[model samples]
Each structure stands twice: as C-alpha cells, then as structure tokens.
Target: MKSWLWLLVGLWPAFASGNDEAAELLKRVRAQHSADVVVSRYEIEIVRTEWQRTVIMAVTEDQRGGRYQGMVIAPRRLADTLYLKRDGRLWMVIPRLRRKVGISPAMLSEPWMGSDLSNQDILQGDAVIDDYQHRVIARDGDLVTIESTPLPGRPALWRRLRQQVRRDAVPVRVDYFDQDDVLQRRIEFSEVGEVGERRLPMVWRIVPMPEKGEYTLLKVSGVEFDPTLPDDAFNALEQATAGTATSP
Candidate 1:
C-alpha cells in the first residue's frame, strides 16, 4: 500500500505539462458520452475458446446520481437477474436463488455476469476518465493517443489506459493495463454514427490479452439518451420504465 502511494507521488510531476490540453480533449469525449438519463437494451455476446454465450439486458442508468440498474432479458436460466449500483456500493440480486449480496472487493474485480468485462467496467463508466490523469502521448493524422493513469486512492481497476480518440474527440479504442504496465485488455469502439446529438459507438468489442480467444461484444440494440425520466423512474421498479424517446 505504501509503495503504491509512493509510486503515484513519484509519477505526479511528469504529467503536469499538457494537462490542460488533455483536460480539454477529455471534456469533449465526456460530453459525447454524457447523458442525464440513459435507457437502452444491450446485447452482450461472450465468446470463449471452449464455448460461447449471449445475454440480453435492459439497462436504466441515472448518470446524474451515479446509479445504475440492469436486468437480464434473455436465457431462461439467468433471466430476470438484476444488478444495482448505488451510493458507491454494488449489489447483485439473484432471483433464481432468492438472494441479494453485496459485491466484495475481490468480486468487484471479477468478470461481470461471466463476461470478460469487469464489474467496474459495466457499473462505472465515469471512472474511465474521471478517476484518471490524462496526457497526450502520440498523434497520427486525425487520431490522437492519450495515456491516463489512475489517481491515487481512486477505485480504478486499471492502473493505466491508452485511449485512441478521433479529432472530434470521439474515442475509437482504449487499452487497459495493470499496475506493472502489462497490457490486460483492449476495448474497441465502432459502428459510429449519431445517437441523439452525440457521435456514439453503437458496437463495443472488448478483447482480453495474451492470445486468449476470449472477448465480449456489446451492441446497442435500442437506446434513447437524456430522456425526461419519470420521478419514480429510479425509485420504483413497477413504474420505473424509462421515459419516451425514439431511436432511429
């Protein structure tokens, strides 16, 4: 623990220069991802060398309060399984077992719903940028590569991230690395087009490193962003359905 703190302190001075430019670029990227309320259906395909599985989910996340809720919509066995994150706590409620359990620190780092993606990856999208200090590392034509390090004491799963973003500040890909700077995973964004007012990635594919034929693909089946959610939307389950908005 002490060593990690020392490492973060030692690394702080190097990222000071160009932090302004990095900050501005991240702001635009955040704007592209930001929404007051996000209601969407996601089709997640988990692929492995031995087998493959797919899960469909309905998600309603209140970005303003940092609360997220999701329920499985497919695969009879795991159907109706629910997940919730509120007030910095993660909970997984299994209707099959009639159990609700808080996620432990170890479990928090594990695969989310048996997918290659981590729990933090699904529950805290804000932490990708908000918990990291970023700096421009490289540039090529319309593509800019930026390296980001986790802020000290932050609950960031990855120690560092290298994100390739477009000139318009839309993120194209992100590589996640551990504390030792070993590449762990890569997330690529494509099928880019306008979603509401933002140029969003309709398909996201995450690949694990070290020649493992394991990955997860999340495609937005239907989505509407920043809709006027009902007041009881996040408070009550029965009437908590997302507000009206059409996806084109």
Candidate 2:
C-alpha cells in the first residue's frame, strides 16, 4: 500500500506543479491555435543599392506550430518566386520554369537578399522544442523570461535562445546565440495584438551579429488572419500570364 501511495504522489506533480505548469501552458498555447493561423500580404522594399526595387510577398505564419510559406513577386522581372514549406520540406518555385527546386541544408547559412538574414534564420522559429530546453527564469512587469538551452541534437549551430513571454504568456522576443555562446541575433516583436483572439507579433527586427554591421527588419503590415487565399493563387501559370515571369 505504501508503494501504491508513493506512485500516486509522484504522478500528482506531473499533472500539477511548477516546471510542469509552464510546460503545460506552452502545450496549451500551441494546441489551441493549431488550426488557426495568421496570413498577411506585405510590400518588401530592400534598399541595398542606388536602384531601390520593390517586391510583393504573401506570407503565412502559425503560432507555436510548423509551416511557413512566402511568395515573393518581383515587379516587371523574370519570374515570380515561391518559397513553400510542405511536410517539413522547403522548396523554391520559379514561374518561368514551373519547377520547384529543393533548398539544401547547406544554403541555410547563405545570406538572404544580401542581408544578415538567412533562409535558415526565417525557418528557425519553428520547432522550438527541437532547438531549446526551456526553463522559466523570471517575471518582470507582466513579462516572463524563459531561458532556453540549445539541445545537443540540434542540427544547426546555435548556442542558446531566450524567449520573452507577455504577462498573459505569449512569446514576444526571441534571442539567438552562436556555437561559441556569443550573442548572434536578437528578434524584437512590436505592435503585438490579437489576430482572431490569439496574440501575435506584427513587426519583427533581426539585429546584427557582433562585428556584423547593419541588420534586417521585417515589418508585417496589413495583417489579416484566415483569409480567402485560394490555392490557385500559388499557380505558376498565373504568374506567367501576369507578365511577372518568363518561360523556364
């Protein structure tokens, strides 16, 4: 009977406790918004040279979930570009070719748009569980800091990630570290509000790594969640007809 009592006592904390509480909350947040996602249309302007060009992008991001796709359109250019995440596979599509090219794991380290940001950087936000071991560090003004230690099994070279949660327990800031345990990137979230009752980050700034001057800023303006975006909008023929792409 004493052994039975001990087993029950141990199980109680698993269903209710301190470390378990934060874990449960994270699980709940991830589960609650699994079906609901946020989508937006963005106008991207990257000014790296004297000739500034504009691009239109359609994006979709899930909260605490996997999957993010961006369709980049170059005005009066060769072809519209498509970046897709299907079943954990990342592919790039060119309208002219009508073929999807697989993005290799090696390209992740390459700079994106000649900026400090990389393709891997954008994809890193997904699979937080696979990257960091979480611990509730502290609470300050309705905000909580959760220090995350990078797991040994992570394929990428990241040292640590510290995420800041709002008073209501939503992730706001995510900071990244290098393999040498040096701060590499800081992602700042602003204009946070509700997207169909789920709090989300609207604007993001990717800060520069030490010794790496300049940074990348991704602003999500005119955000609308759960829209009537049709699968046909992603069709390659449409891009060709629109004169946005050439023949592959």
Work out the TM-score per prediction. Answer: 0.83, 0.70
For candidate 2, the TM-score is 0.70
* Span of ten consecutive residues with least summed lDDT in model 1: 1-10
lDDT values of the candidates? Answer: 0.67, 0.53
lDDT of 1 by residue, 116-228 (tens): 77666554554344457878899899998878887777766678878788878666887879878899888788898787677767778889887487898988787777777
Judged by lDDT, which candidate is best? 1
Candidate 2, 172-227: lDDT as tens digits = 67677877878887766677667667665555555665634355555555566555
Worst 10 residues of 2 by lDDT: 1-10
Model 1 TM-score, 2 decimals: 0.83
Q: What's the lDDT for residue 106 in model 1? A: 64
